[model samples]
Target: MITAAVLAALAMACAMGAWRLTFAKWPWRAPRAAILLWQSLGVTWGLASVGALLAYALEPYGGGVVYGLHAFVDSAVSFGTGHGLLKPYDLPRVSALIAGLTLLAVLVTVLLAAGVQTLRARRRHRVLLALIAHEDPGVPGVRVVDHPGAAAYCLPGLMGSEVVVSAGTLSLLHPDELTAVLAHEAAHARERHDLVLLPFTALNWALPWLSVVRNAHSSVALLVEMAADDRARRYCSPRRLATALLRFGTAGAVPAPDGALGASGEHVMARVNRLVKPGPTFPRHARVSVITFSILLSASAPLLWIYPA
Candidate 1:
């Protein structure tokens, strides 16, 4: 019975995580703060799922299954009754210890997951920033560095990567259009899209079975780009930006560095399409729904413990 409950809980947690990650409306326009929150929830859900899986594996009837097994076990082990898994004499100390250990485990898991990722990101940022600083010279506010590659990239940090606009790209875009391109790259650096993406990417890599996480990551990626585009539009004419996107699409300049933010090859067409046909405004209700769902999912494990089935 414990095993069945654990499995059901695991399934529920996974489903909930998936939905929270992937079900956003107007995903591209979502605020940076909101994306951060979504990624945090995803990490929390993944952690809870891991805990539930551990519980399931440790449960008895490890290799056997029976219908209504969980209910039977729960009935047989009713906590206040003499027939329960914890007898009156065993209840106090054992239950207290188990509860204490579970709390500790949860704390350790959250810290480990978040700490490891934070440390790695800090290390990578330090290394990447030093490399970019050494390689590129700059002008205040905005300056373009010439690099001989098929790649377009914006390095973003305290000492951000010099916006590397390839020579081929200069010929492809008109002057005002080029400004839009630069603005887009600047927006990426300013918003720190890479940092925002880190947790979601980690979740996707860690929990590949959750297709919803991958979808969420993809959606977030697309949205971040759009959000950057919107920022670019604020400085440059949207028509010029749209034209630049078209030209860049035609020029086929690939994105530089696995880590840099730019309209990478994979999503160039989608981006151009969006530029040409921008979507309707994101609704407040959609944001509320997404946030509400995330809150419920994040609370699920604790809720289950409080009101055990």
Candidate 2:
């Protein structure tokens, strides 16, 4: 079926081309668009993976995978709705259904597992924050630990998110630079960047050997830092943010704490370059077109199920 072929092709392309898609220079001008496109790619890649397997199993469907699936579902629904008799599925159909359902269930299980693990990590880090970190009224809700290195990161939760920084890190920056750093860290917590990265993390767990998963994980991580930078930029000067990055980030290397994301969490050089270069605005039409393409391509997998082959 065209749908099956398309899904296969999409999976292959994503597996092969995710790096180019995520690391393109054009995204600098359209960070939000790039974020959407990346999110869509991550979601569709998983679905396409399962759909591609089901496509092979449904080979016995003369009208192609989608057609047989469509007809089978129609029959099941008809029987359930009491509009028709329940026709027993043939062995091949039963096998295909079981295989398809199993794959889908596995995908779901992976996602849920990723979510649970991330939450557990966040909870543990939050416990550490409460125990070792002290609340500073000057910084308001932020937690400051008396560590030697200049580090700033956040433990995110729905109600009890904590923005953490080292006391030595505080000593290294000007007040404005500190403000910029806090804004950047807050952006991570406020926007819930970890959740955005979760699906890719799950994919990587599911397919650790796949280069696309590794590339996507790192690329999405960098893009999220950029996204946080974009948020920080709204509150502070890019120069100050870049300056903070230079001193606290480069030599100091304030690493992201366990399960928590950091200001300098990914693509340090690339992120610094972005802050320093401050590239020109990308054309609105180009961003729109790319976003549209991403949406349609991501939607195609599900749409395939909606339409018959």
Candidate 3:
């Protein structure tokens, strides 16, 4: 009933915020918290859907909610498995469960497809790279490819992951600048930003026409880059990192290799601007509050159905 409307409203709010964030640069002011918020938004949408369905199913039942819920679940189980006929009052729960189950399956399938697609693309790139790339001990933990253009990206895998920089890029940057680039790529690999990007990829696949899907992907991608920049800035000079990005920006978008995240994948100007005019980081309390809100918001949806008390 009312909770169903509340769930729908929360989902819409998250979607609207995601769409608006795509056009806004305020999130970069505190990249870590922003990334967490994006994650929460994604989780909130899925949970709210389930909650809405549950609230709708429960709306027709009154008195002895505990016993009604038991009957509802029993009916749902029987309907789902084709075992028994449902009482008219129990039909809503059975239908709701079926819809919720279908939604869950589709979500899971999309994510699995995205992950497989990414891994396959990366495997193909890695195979091609093995033939043309050479190991450069100078960079320590990365590989160097003698390509014409300046493209730097990381290939992550189950056994081993490789961070690759083109020869043109190596020759273009100063020593410190090169390290900054490495640090940024390393951050991506270390944090498994690929996994973080997976849900957005799935969303885009499942909802190609929805602007919210595209906006969420774009916003999430930039946040990942900004998070990496912050990590690199910890060990390297912010100016050096900014310089590398500026240089990469001039080198033109070296389209991040398929399935891999490149140093300059679109948002080059926004990233450079951020480094140039460093934004204020989220304070300790502020970060805690953001995280707390995310946890509660995400939990609210599931809690409404599971433990309504």
Model 3, C-alpha of 64: deviation from truth (Å): 13
Clash pairs, model 1 backbone? 1-70, 28-223, 155-161
Question: Looking at candidate 3, what is the lDDT of residue 25?
Answer: 60
Model 3 error, position 17 (Å):
3.2
Q: Cα miss at 40, model 1 (Å)?
A: 5.0
Ranking by TM-score: 3, 2, 1
TM-score of each: 0.61, 0.85, 0.87
- Best-matching candidate per lDDT: 3
lDDT for each residue of candidate 2 in 1-309, tens digit (9 for 90 to 100): 566677778877766557787557777667778878888777677677667656655644545456766656777799899996543346754665677778788778999998898889888887777789998877888899998888888778878577889988888889999999999988988888888888888878897997867887877777888989999999999989988888865566667866788877556767778888878888888888988988897897777554444
Q: What is the C-alpha RMSD of each candidate to the true structure, in Å?
A: 8.8, 3.9, 3.3
Model 3: per-residue Cα lDDT at residue 122 = 91
Model 1, 1-309: lDDT tens per residue? 353365456556566755764665456555553565565465555544444443433234232222123443564578557755531134443353355356546555654575466556555745654454333232334433454433446765555545666655666677787778888888888888877776666656655686776787787787778778888879988778777776666666665554567755456666677767778866778778767766765666554432332
Better of 1 and 2 by lDDT: 2
For lDDT, candidate 2 versus 3, the one ahead is 3
